[model samples]
Target chain A: DQQVKQNSPSLSVQEGRISILNCDYTNSMFDYFLWYKKYPAEGPTFLISISSIKDKNEDGRFTVFLNKSAKHLSLHIVPSQPGDSAVYFCAADDTANTGNQFYFGTGTSLTVIP
Target chain B: DVKVTQSSRYLVKRTGEKVFLECVQDMDHENMFWYRQDPGLGLRLIYFSYDVKMKEKGDIPEGYSVSREKKERFSLILESASTNQTSMYLCASRRGGSTYGYTFGSGTRLTVV
Candidate 1:
């Protein structure tokens, strides 16, 4: 069973527009969430994250919103650029567990058209 | 800067052959993990080690095994290569008490013939 899900397989948006990627989790035990961006032929890089205690967190052009009640989170990028085109993965971990095991979503491929 | 290094970028092996994928982290993190990425499966953890000579199986560890003889190195072993095992393997590491997540390696794409 997939604990984390990214329903949208692919997304397309025009340059300088807003790009939003959504993710949902089924397990309520997860307390920390993270977003990772991956380029071709490279490993995923950390993007942004949110704790269950907070509703929103922002870093420059990237923002993450968490809805604990709905078990959902989204990543928003404003004025999207062509360089922002890549696969985004949503991950969650239950810090209460000593193992620190993380679960990952299937991933959403975002293509920013220029 | 934290760096996780995989020994190889690509590899080709025959069925019944033994394969070893190596990873090393420069940050001296206490936790290291191995995961495999398939077409639609994303990334699934195979195994992880929290300390030297300590290993734990993750979600999918049927045909795989792991080794953590030292603090900085972790290895994934395939006892008998199979075609279905042909996929991208990733290694990652994170600090013991750090709030941040893991730092990943570039990944190793292994093909079994």
Candidate 2:
């Protein structure tokens, strides 16, 4: 069973425009959510994160919004740049478990067209 | 800066051969994980260790095993490589008792022929 899912496989946006990538999860036990960006051959780097207690968190050009009631979350990038083009993955952390296992979505490939 | 290093960026092995993937973290993170990324399937955890010598099976661990002899090093082993096991293997580490995100290595692209 896939607890976390990214419905969209890819998204393309014009540079300087807003890019929104959405994610959904079925498990309510998740308390932390994070977004990671990955280039072609590089590993994923953490972009932003939001706690379930808060509805939103922002870092400069990046922001993450969590809607616990809807079991959904979205990552928004303002003034999207060509450098931001990469595969974005949304992950949920289950801290209740000893392993602190994280569930990741299928990932959305974002393309910033210049 | 904290870093997670994967031994090989790319590897190729014949079917039925044993394969080993090594990972080391400089952050001294207590939690280490091995995940395989496949298209449309996302990142599937193969195994993880929260402490040295202690490991737990993740969502997918049927054909894979792991070893954590030290807090900073984690190894993923394939008993018998199969073509189906070809994927991008990523190693990640996180500090204990932290809800923060994990630091991932560059990832190893393994191909089993």
Candidate 3:
């Protein structure tokens, strides 16, 4: 069973526009959520993270919003740049169940067209 | 900076051969993981070790095994390589806590012919 799921397989956005990538999880025990970006032939790098205690977290042009009630989270990149084009993965972890073991989504390929 | 180094960037092995993928982390992290990424499959954990000599099986560990002899190294072994096992393998390490994210090494692309 896939605990974490990224419904959109890919997304294309114009440069300088807002790009939203969404994720959903079935496990209610998950308290920590994170987003990672991966370029071709490279490892996925951590972009942002949000804890269940907070509804939203932001860093520079990236923001992550978590909705516990809906079991959904979204990563938004403001003024998306061509450099942001890569595969985005959303991950969830239930610390109480399995510490530091995260469930990853299939990932969404984001393209920032310049 | 934390550094996780994978021994090989790419490897080609014949089917039915034993294959070993090695990972070393310089941060002395207690937790290390082996994951294989396939198209539309995301990252599937094959094995993980939270402490030296302690191993845990992940969601997909059917044909994979792991070893953690030292605190800085984790090795993933395929008893017998299969064509279906060809994928990009990623190694990651993190401290034993939920607050920190994982640091991944540049993945190794393994091909079994």
Candidate 4:
């Protein structure tokens, strides 16, 4: 079963436009959420994160919004650039049980067209 | 900076052969994990170690095992390789502090024939 889900397999947006990637989770114990970006050859790199305590966290052009009630979170990038084209993954972790287990989404491939 | 290094970038092996993938991290994090990435199946954890000589099985650990004799080093072993095992393997480390995340290695693409 897919505990965490990213329904959109691919997303396309024009440069200087807004790009949003959405993720949903089934398990409610997850308190920490993270977003990762992956290129073709390299491993996934941490992009941004948000805690369960807050609803939104913004860093420069990247922002993450979390809604605890709906078990959903999203990543938004403003004025998207060509360099931003890559696969994005959403990960959720529950520290209450085994702090090590993290459930990840299938990933959304975002292509920012210039 | 925290850097996680994988021993190989690509590997090809035959079925039933033993395969070893090594990972080393510069950061002295207490937690190291092994995950596999496949098409339509983002990343699935195989195993992890919180301390030296300590190991825990993650979501998918049936065909794999791990060894962590040193703090900075972790190894994933495939006792009998299979074609379905062909996928990208990733290694990551997280500090014990509440930071609660990981620094990842480049990745290893393994193909079993």
Using Cα atoms, each model's DockQ against the true complex is 0.74, 0.83, 0.77, 0.67
| Location of the lowest summed lDDT over 10 successive residues in candidate 2 chain A | A93-102
| Model 1 regions more than 4 Å off | none
**Where in model 4 is the C-alpha error above 4 Å?**
none
Candidate 4 residue lDDT tens string, A7-68: 99999999999999999999988999999999987999999999999999999999999999
Q: Which residue ranges in model 2 land beyond 4 Å of their true spot? A: none
Model 3 TM-score is 0.98
- lDDT (Cα, tens digit) per residue for candidate 3, span B15-110: 999999999999978899999999999999999999999999999999999999999999999999999999999999988865788999999999
Stronger candidate by TM-score (1 vs 4): 1
lDDT of 4 by residue, B1-113 (tens): 66999999999999999999999999888899999998778999999998999999989999999999999999999999999899999999988645477889999999999
Task: Estimate, for each residue in B1-113, the C-alpha lDDT of model 1 and write its tens digit.
Answer: 77999999999999999999999999989999999988678889999999999999999999998999999999999999999999999999988765679899999999999
- In model 3, the clashing pairs are none
Interface RMSD after interface superposition, model 3: 1.3
For every candidate, C-alpha RMSD to the true structure in Å: 0.9, 0.9, 0.9, 1.2
TM-score of every model?
0.97, 0.98, 0.98, 0.96
Worst 10 residues of 1 chain A by lDDT: A93-102
Interface RMSD of each: 1.0, 0.8, 1.3, 1.5
